[model samples]
Target: MSKIIALSGTKNGVISIRKINEPYGPGSGTVASVGISLSGESENPEWKVHIPLDNLDEVIKALSELK
Candidate 1:
């Protein structure tokens, strides 16, 4: 099975960061992804974001500033 590394667990949800090592196989592929996952409630839905490593800092900053 493919390996998945979980950096931390949170009450809100969890964040996963995977480091990609290539040549992964035949076709071209991504280098890495930073993800933010949220659990669904009765009215909401579960979702995950596959964020580019370069944009992670900006995204995190924006999220942190949310009120």
Candidate 2:
């Protein structure tokens, strides 16, 4: 599954969030993949980070504290 976030002040810019399995290959487990693209290319973003599923909650909490 995936979700997209449009960015303001930039044409076609977006952030994508997706769930990926074995992104690093078999036995790598799953991750919450977050990507940013200034060209609206969710499949090939300019920047990305993969957060292990187990760390999702703490990551969310930390991000929330930044808000």
Candidate 3:
């Protein structure tokens, strides 16, 4: 699954979320990827982070707590 969102305060910026399978090659497993692109190019993000599926829940909880 994947999603794209317009970034606040920027005309052409965007944020993208996706599930990547074996992003680091075979055996790397799947990951939840979050990316940001100030240039509006979701395929080539200026910043990105990959969260392991095993840690997703905890990560979400932590992020929520910050809100």
Best by lDDT, which number? 3
Report the lDDT tens digits of candidate 3 across residue range 2-65.
9999999999999999999999999997999999999999999999999999999999999999
Q: Name model 1 segments beyond 4 Å from true.
A: 1-46
Best by TM-score: 3
The predicted structure with the larger TM-score, 2 or 3, is 3
Q: List the residue pairs that clash in candidate 1.
A: none
True-vs-predicted CA distance for residue 32, candidate 3, Å: 0.5
Order the numbered candidates by TM-score, best leading: 3, 2, 1
lDDT tens digits, residue span 1-67, model 2: 9999997889999999999999999999799999999999988999999999999999999999999
The 10 consecutive residues of candidate 2 with the worst lDDT sum are 7-16
TM-score of each: 0.36, 0.94, 0.95
**Candidate 2: which stretches are off by over 4 Å?**
none
Candidate 1, residues 19-65: lDDT per residue as tens digits?
A: 54432465535444444555413123244334555666788799899
For model 3, the superposed segments whose C-alpha errors exceed 4 Å read: none
TM-score of 2: 0.94
